[model samples]
Target: DCKKAVSGKSFYAMEGKPVCPKCVGVDEEEEEEEEA
Candidate 1:
């Protein structure tokens, strides 16, 4: 699970809020591509 977070393969959350740094990075990248 930790490895997945580090690699941005999955996201972690607490109380329904995202807590994984890598997931945020991956999400941002996806959003940028979508905008493009």
Candidate 2:
């Protein structure tokens, strides 16, 4: 996992859950993809 801060990069973008901007570019994970 990325250790970079994604505060202003994607603050409150997905409800109240804060996601890492570094990992945003990665789409190899099918975890949330299946649910979405």
Model 2 C-alpha lDDT versus the unseen true structure: 0.47
**Model 2 Cα lDDT, one tens digit per residue, 1-36:** 344564445432344455564455544333455534
Write candidate 1's Cα lDDT for 1-36 as tens digits.
Answer: 223434544455745775565544445345445443
Question: How many pairs of residues collide in model 2?
Answer: 0
The Cα local distance difference test for each model comes to: 0.48, 0.47
Worst 10 residues of 1 by lDDT: 1-10
Candidate 1 lDDT (Cα, whole model)? 0.48
Worst 10 residues of 2 by lDDT: 6-15
Number of clashes in every candidate structure?
A: 0, 0
TM-score of each: 0.24, 0.24
